[model samples]
Target: MIELGVLFGLLAAAVLALIFVLLRRGNGSTENADGLLVEQARRLQAHNDRVSYNAASVRSSSPTTTDHYRP
Candidate 1:
């Protein structure tokens, strides 16, 4: 029972150490967040523009009347 307790303590300490290391390494990645945001914004704008253009074309080509056999 003592050996099992020691093994569990060692495993818990190793896991905590690993988590601390990963958090420290992840702290340096905040510098590129602005660039990523700008890129994502540009992509969103382009997609919105394409959607608006398609919507306009569809609106212009659509029929205003309900009668399909008249035209």
Candidate 2:
């Protein structure tokens, strides 16, 4: 009877350890995904800013039809 009790205790401890490790791994993966998304968003915003700046510069430097249509 004493041997049976020791076996059950060991089994329970092993199962608990496995569950803890799996849960920790699942959380780590979620954090990694979140970090990747944040990095991508930062890069997208930088690209958009550059494009907007270029467009504004082009508009300011180009001549308009109004310049030639005045009486």
Candidate 3:
């Protein structure tokens, strides 16, 4: 029972130390992150436009009528 208590106390102390270290670490600038996000958005928009254009072209070029059913 005493050994188990000592083990839990040591584990708790380690966890607290880790938390303290993480909290002490300062957050860096967001300028680079913002730039990256903006670039990603632009690329995504371009990809979407290309996809839309391809779909439109395929839809227009494909046959609309079925040979088995004639009106």
Candidate 4:
């Protein structure tokens, strides 16, 4: 139908306009900053140690005992 042709032309024009708008706005962001990613990789590797730990472990410091508390 002639109506169908007109509809397709309108849809194609809208899509082309949207593509131009996006091209002008350009692309988006970076996931990491500079050497931070490299340092993080090193830290992650160091953290991969066999010791089992979770958030609670990170929050707690080592237990401290004085001579008076000797077993």
lDDT digits (tens) for residues 1-71 of candidate 4: 99999999999999999999999988665566866788889888778752346443653544352344448
Q: lDDT by residue for model 2 over 4-57, one digit each (tens)?
A: 999999999999999999988774445358788998999999998887777447
Tens digit per residue, CA lDDT, model 1, 1-71: 99999999999999999999998887455576898898899999999888778734756544553544565
Model 1 lDDT on a 0 to 1 scale? 0.80
Q: Where is the poorest 10-residue window by lDDT in model 4?
A: 61-70
TM-score winner among the candidates?
3
lDDT of 3 at 50: 83
After TM-score superposition, the amount by which residue 6's alpha carbon in candidate 3 deviates from its true location, in angstroms, is: 0.5
RMSD of 2: 16.1
Give the runs in model 3 whose Cα sits over 4 Å from its true position. 30-71
TM-scores, one per candidate: 0.39, 0.38, 0.40, 0.38
* lDDT score of residue 34 within candidate 4: 62
Model 3 global lDDT (CA atoms, 0 to 1)? 0.80
